[model samples]
Target: MRKRVTMCQWLSDKIDDEPEFLDNMWFSDEAHFLLSGHVNSKNNIFWGSTPPDHCLQRPLHSVKCTAWVAISTHGIIGPFWFEDDDERSLTVNTERYIQVLRKFWVALGRRRGIDRALQWFQQDGATPHTSDRSLEWLQQRFEDRLISRRCHPEWSPHSPDLNPPDFYLWGYLKDRVYEHNPQTIPDLKAAITAAIRAIPREECRRVIENFARRIQ
Candidate 1:
């Protein structure tokens, strides 16, 4: 709580110095969309006369995909999927993350007619996001526009509430996607894409605009 208060104070000071700070800010994060919708012991519940033994058997391999998404007051950037190299799932590395950023930048440029020099990019302290190679790539492209572990005005670690995508968008997306109850990987992907697209531009702007209030 102390750390959160301190971080909020720091953000408040920054916002006070620059009233337009949130306008240029972009938030990015990655989330896994599971085929089974993240069913866990605590949340999983069944009601029946008899114990459903067959339904209790867990799969040896759970099907899932990781998607990277970014949003700004202008609009959204992507639902970019992290490729699976082997049969097993893979974590995003610096190389893959950079590739995603390249695509995201192109899309962002096309949509907003803005360059990296004019924007502030915020990312969490994930290993791939903070790696030396990743930092170098971001520095070369975004320069001082970065907000990460090693960047100035660094984001508070483990503080997802400070990020709109984490605090609002992801949960909103997950709820909508699960409503479709997709049965396959492609279906899940389609659902996620559709849900993101369906989000109103005004709502997105409202969330981004509320950043100042959140910090206060």
Candidate 2:
């Protein structure tokens, strides 16, 4: 772990080209760093991430979750947590996802909204985005805003250098909730939201920027 940590710092430094370049890249490009989805459930509400053994058992539960995340390279996008289920319901989770995505242009308004003008967004080619409904929704929502998309999860996989949530967010979650066990789903859910909120925004931004420099 120490070696990995050192290597991560080295890589982070080189990829970024400078100490602050990492953060600048995010704010400058308006890129969105993404990753494989996170799992949330009733019976098993542990923190951090699913252990390697339980990684791909989704089909069994059929519990729905959606592609609910957003980012600004500068900061977190609005968080829209949902089950990887269907698209029938317009719950806050789903609507929240849209709202967060929409806020980029509304707030940035052709100025900071590089995504709106260049039509570029970074994401994996998950089934949801490929689905007819989600595709149509994005088409209507962003129009020409989404330019080149990074589709294959493996290619870039995720920019460990520029994406800190991969390391920091889980660490924060585990640190706070692992001790709790969070016996109930609702309890776990509340704990997660609280943990997320507790993280200092500037700290998260620093970590996210540092990620751009981490080596594999």
Candidate 3:
């Protein structure tokens, strides 16, 4: 659970050695997922149109899919939903992925002028993130605010328990959004927005602060 305190320690020292994780004082990149099916009966029935012989629309198994997202404790930076497939069609690609990150930076600094550069940023070593192109872009665009980006191998994608938005945030959102079956994409999207807004700041802190304990 405790590999090293590279991220927090560095950010802490820069901002003064004070606690940061739970104080609503940090930022991180996150991904969002939209599941296609629910944990209903093993042999549930879908009441939509189907072949004369087919009884329902339910798949034989659960179809959980994900979207690439970058968010922080303050609020959502942005979200990019991937093309939905049977799930196998999805592969983690860093090249196209960096585009989403680029868009996030634009929103944080250029569009909104929130100056996310002043905030701490953390993310996993997904292929695009570590690629020469992505880093080069970061170096070019963020030349002045280079200090804003926090680098830590330990904070990369391999570790999810440390990031509560995956475990805690989505579940909270899903429970609220999937209150009923979402037959279409728009139905699902509305649910997602509602859920994201509902999660309290304190709840997010609990998950991130106790990340190490949870991992252990």
Candidate 4:
């Protein structure tokens, strides 16, 4: 809690010092979408004294996919699907991450009118994200407009509360996506995309604008 508070303070101070910080920033993260929707254990409360009749059996293995998405105050960017490697399992390597970044950069310009040179990108410290090759690629394009392990204004470890996607956007989308209980991978992907599209521009702006208050 102390670390989180300190980090929040640091963020708040930065935002105050640079009023244009939020406007030019893009927040990015990856999330896994499972065939079986995410069931929040805390929301499974039973009212009966004897206990609920439901028995939730955990799946031994579930079909899932990793998707990378980015958002700015303007709007949401790519919910790009990660390509599976030789093992036929989706894993983000430096090369794959770079590919997503390249595609997402183009999408940002076409969809949101954000130029790579004008935006400050934020990403968490996943292994692929922090790799030397990935860092170099980001540097070449975004120059100093990056927030990562090897960049200025680094994100703190294990601090999901500071990330808009983790704290708000993903949860919001999951709640809507799971409403249909999508049965197949394609259905799940469509549901996820639809949910993202449904998010209002005002909501995006509000979340981005509220960052300073949240940190405080």
Candidate 5:
């Protein structure tokens, strides 16, 4: 808690100094959308008199897609799905993460007319994000404006509440996407994409305002 407060204060100070900090800060994270979707076992009750064998077995290889999104006051950069060269869903590694930023962030930034030099990138201290190579790549692009571990204005550990995507976007997306109850990977991805597209730009601006209040 002490560390979190310290980091929050540091960020608050930075924001005070630079009014556009939160606007220019691109906060990012990723979440996995499972084909099974979010299970609420609490609502499950056996209606039979005999107690049947009650174990539900999931598949050995369940289909899912890891979706990444980066949000700023401008808009969302992506619902970028992490996949291999063959288009199979894959976990994020340093190489794959860099590729996503280079491909989605760079290309999308250009299309959106966002100045790369003015953007402050914020990411949690995930393994791939904190890796030496990944940090080097991020530094080359964002330099001293990064909000991450081992970077300027280092993000506090386990402080997802400080990030807009964690405190707002993910829950909002998941609730809407799971309503579709997608039974296949493609359906799940489609649901996620639709949900993301449905988000209003005003909502995103409000989220950034909420983030500013949070750190303050």
Candidate 6:
């Protein structure tokens, strides 16, 4: 609790000191979207003379897809699917996370002609994100601007409420994605991608504005 408070203050001050910090910072995180988890009772509606018996069967080991994204005031960086070398779906580990970052993040920067020095990267203290090699790779690019477990001011562990992706993006996407009631993994993935692309730039700016207020 103390650490969380301290870092919040530190970040709040940093935001005050650097006017462009929020816009340049890329806050990243991952989430698992399950097919079975899409079941919402409120969405089930039937109009008939008699009440109909409805049963929604969900698999025991539900098929799911994990997606990673980075958002900032500039806009969202990705809705990248976490897949293996063979193009099979998989959970995130140190190796896979590093691979995705190198492939997608690096490629995006190069393609857009973005200078590494102008942007800062933020990640939470998840084991895969904080491992020695991971920190080293982030340090090589972001230098002192990297925000994570061992970085300068460090990030609070139990502070998802502080991350834009956590506080806003995931919930925002899930609400619309599941609204379509995707029954298959492919359908879920399509819905997610569509929802991501639908987020307007104005909303992103407002999200960062809210973030600034919270940290302060």
lDDT of 4 by residue, 52-164 (tens): 67887867677777778987788888688885653233778888899999998788768645565677888988999999999998888889878886567667777677688
* Regions more than 4 Å wrong, model 5: 39-61, 111-113
lDDT: the better of candidates 2 and 5: 5
The per-model lDDT (C-alpha) reads 0.80, 0.42, 0.51, 0.78, 0.81, 0.81
Q: For each of the candidates, give the backbone clash count.
A: 0, 19, 3, 0, 0, 0
Question: Between the candidate structures 4 and 6, which one is better when assessed by lDDT?
Answer: 6
Q: How does model 6 fare in lDDT?
A: 0.81
TM-score winner, 1 or 5? 5
Consecutive 10-residue window with the lowest summed lDDT within model 3: 144-153
Better-scoring candidate (TM-score), 2 or 6: 6
Cα shift from native, residue 214, model 5 (Å): 1.4
Q: lDDT per residue, candidate 3, 1-216, as tens digits?
A: 233455445444543444543332333444434456454421224575665774567555444444455445455644455443432324456666566666766666753435554444555555556567766766565543332223432353344445555545555665677778777666676567666666675655565556535433
**By TM-score, highest first, what's the ranking?**
5, 6, 4, 1, 3, 2
Candidate number of the best TM-score: 5
Name the candidate, 3 or 5, with the larger lDDT value: 5
TM-score of each: 0.84, 0.46, 0.61, 0.84, 0.86, 0.86
lDDT, candidate 5, 1-216, per-residue tens: 777888899988888899987778889998776677643322234588787777777766667788899998887878887997666799899998998888765655575666777888889999999999999988887788888987767789878777888888887887888886888777888888888888888889999999888877
**Clash pairs (backbone) in predicted model 6:** none
lDDT of 6 by residue, 70-169 (tens): 8777677777878756545797888878887886566557635456688888899999999988888788877898889888778987888888888888
Candidate 4's error at 165, in angstroms? 0.5
Candidate 1 local lDDT, 91-133, one digit each (tens): 7988889988889888877874566677888898999999999
Error of 1 at 161 (Å): 1.4
